[model samples]
Target: MGSLVVFFQLAGAVALLLFGLSLVRDGMTEAFGVRLKMALGLGTRTGPRAFLSGLLATLGLQSSTATALMTASFVERDLIRGRMAQIALLGANVGTALTAWFVSAGIEAIAPVLLFSGYVLGRRKGPVWLGTGRALIGVGLMLISLALLGHATEPLRNAPEIAAFLPMLDAAWPVALLFAAAIAALCSSSLAAVLLILSLPLPPGLTVVLVLGANLGGAVSPVLATSGLGVAARRVALGNLLIRGLGCLAALPVAGLAGAALTGLALPGAGLAVEAHLAFNIALTLLIWPFTGPIARLLTRLLPDEEREQEHGPRWLDDAVLKSPLLALTGASREVLAIGDAVERMLGQTRHAFDSNDPSPLAEVLALEDRVDRRQQQVKTYLSRLGRDASEEENRRAITILDYVINLEHIGDIIDKGLAPEVRKKIGLGLRFSAEGYQELDAMFLMTQENLRMAQTVFMTRDRDMARRLMELKVDIRNMERQSAQRHLIRLRDGQPESRETSSLHLDILRDLKRINAHIASVAHPILDEEGLLIESRLRMG
Candidate 1:
């Protein structure tokens, strides 16, 4: 019963630690996600800057895995070179190690203070304050959990069964390593696993092996998370995994020597696991930093790009189903939804290209636009064959489907021809918006993407409330665009160099995005008109 109680206590402490980590990640992301993303996007111009970018991002996010996935996304958009991404992950590893060191550095005395301050701040309005407060609360909880972990493990220190098991694990380093690796993988956090290991009483050599395992397992989560992404993204994640795996392999043979060296050091108050984690990552970074280029090339060759299968015609539109008007209309609706998906993809790529200042991502926009055109044509042709015998309601439904698909097609064209070209021009001319202007445009881009998603839902469900909300969002978009344009002019008048240089480009993008939102919002109009919610005309009493 005592052992069981101890087990629950340990489990509870670990859960608190994980929850604290999550709070920190979510709070920081909410508070400074855009600035962090922009900094990461812009900071990778050189090797050292890239490393610092990753280190700082991980420190803020409290997860190297998050940094790795973000970096992979950037790589997918051609924002950062693959070689630089690898180095960034190297720095992220070190950052996480340092985080562990800090957590275990006798700071639990301030837990109550942090938690109280966090509560006080969290009650305030505004996202920035709320997020920062939540982050502070997370830090407090983490520190408290560390203190609990120490108490929870005190019983195990004298337990004969655990003492017997330690020697067995110490005897088989590979088994011990896998055990720790599995713990890390299951937790999805090496920091958590390492902290847990730190609480256990174990030999120094065994601690080193276990910490190495935690590092290896930590890299696996990102690789798995990004496995479905493009080849470029997959390569970046896979390269990071390979680097960690190699580092672990090389260090495994000398675990004893490394462990002895760490123990021999005069550092006080530092746990063996934390010290080992720091030493291993520092050594790995130094050893692998120079080979990042070769590793990137190796990854590219290993994960060669697969040929994309050409989608010639509508996959969902079947001629045999045309005899049934209801069935045929359903088929057409599904096909139109697919086109909506394609448009969303194109929009995402365009936004990514804009943010990264890379034109490579735009290369897919034209192809997706062509696909949208061909698929819409297929839907129209298929719907035209529904026969003159169709009921009036069925015919009305067919018209609705056609209208929505046509709107989707327009959005695709605007993205491909208007937004794509505008972004390319911005990149080609080395244009940069003022910081305020950039944030305004970025906020609009995000809202536009969100509105597109809502429009899709409205198209399928035709819910009156959602339709109303979609119409409301249209006004919001217009207002945002108008305000952003005015702000751009204000900055230009103030003689801001970035604003002056990119004035035309910024306004053009704002106009195009607003136009796109208008087109997408059209999906809600027919629904609104049918429900007697839509105004017939904006022109009122003379």
Candidate 2:
């Protein structure tokens, strides 16, 4: 019963720690996600800047894993180079250790003050205030959890079961390494694992081994998360893992000596765990940073890009199904959904290209636009062939699908001709949007992407509620675009340097995105019109 109670207490403390970390991550993202993304995207112009970006992003997010995943996504899109990505993650590794060190700085006494401040600030409005408040609250929670963790483990120091089990771990150091690695991997957080390890009363060498294991295991979560991002993403993540794995392999042989040297330092016991974490990453960064270029090249050869099949027309539209109007309409609906998918891809690639000031991704965006054009035409032609014998409702369904495909094609055109060229000009002329201007545009891009996805759902399901929600979001997008343009003009009036050459590009993008949003909102019309919900115009008849 005592053992179970102790286990529950430990688990609760760990859970609180993880929750605190998430709050910090979420708050930072909500407050400054755009600027952070831009820093990570643009900061890769040099290796050192890339490293700093990753380090700072990790510190703010309280999760190196999130930084890694974000970095992998950029690599996948070719917005950042593989070599720089590896270096950045090395920085992220150091950041994680720094976080562990900072939290262990004997300031748990201020937890209540931070908690109160965070709560008061959290109640305030605006992204910055709310985000800062949430982050402070998270920090306070983490500190409190650390105190609780100490209390929980104070008993383990006297527990006979722990005394026996810990010695068993000391006799078999490799087992201890794997045990800590497993804990970090399971928690998906090395900081949590290190803090937990800090609270325990382990032998000096064993404590070092556990920290090493935490570093090694910390690389696992990002690698796993990158599976869905793409091959380049996977490569970036896998590269980090291999680097850390190699470092661990070399360090494992000397854990005792390094542990003894650090433990020999006149520092306190809690400091030992954090110092081990910090020292390992610092040493690993110095040793590995120089070799990141060669290592990235090696990974490319080891995991060469998979060969893709030639692009072909409309995968979902089947002629055999044309005899059945129901099947034919369903296939067309699915085909339009696929076109929306392509459009989403185009927007993503375009946005990345703009952010990086690189025109390479625009080539894929063009290719995808062509694919979108071909698919939409096929959808239209297929519907034209649907027989007159079809019922009125069947004909109406065909028309609805036609309307959606046509609207989707308009979105494609806007992405292809409007946003793509503007982005190219912005990049080609070396024009930079003011930080405020760019943040506004980026927010619209994200909102439009989400609204596009929601529009797809509305078209397929024709759910009145989702349709209404999408329509409402369309209004929000328009308002956002208008507000952004107004802010850009204000910046211009004030003679903001960044607003000078990029004025036309910024306004053009806002207009195009708003137009695209208007088209996407049209998909909700039929569903809404059926429920007597859509207004023909906002104007009042005189």
lDDT of each: 0.88, 0.87
**Residue 387 in candidate 1 has what lDDT?**
70
Candidate 2 — worst ten consecutive residues by lDDT sum? 263-272
Instruction: Report residue 470 deviation for candidate 1 (angstroms).
Output: 11
Which number leads on lDDT?
Answer: 1
Relative to the unseen true structure, what is the C-alpha lDDT of residue 337 in candidate 1, on a scale of 0 to 100?
92
lDDT (Cα, tens digit) per residue for candidate 2, span 415-439? 9999999999998888888878877
Please report, as a residue range, the 10-residue window in candidate 1 with the lowest summed lDDT.
33-42
Give one digit per residue, the lDDT tens place, for model 1 in 338-360.
Answer: 89988988988898888889899
Residue 65, model 2: Cα distance from true site in angstroms: 1.6
Q: Highest TM-score, which number?
A: 2
lDDT for 18 (candidate 2): 95
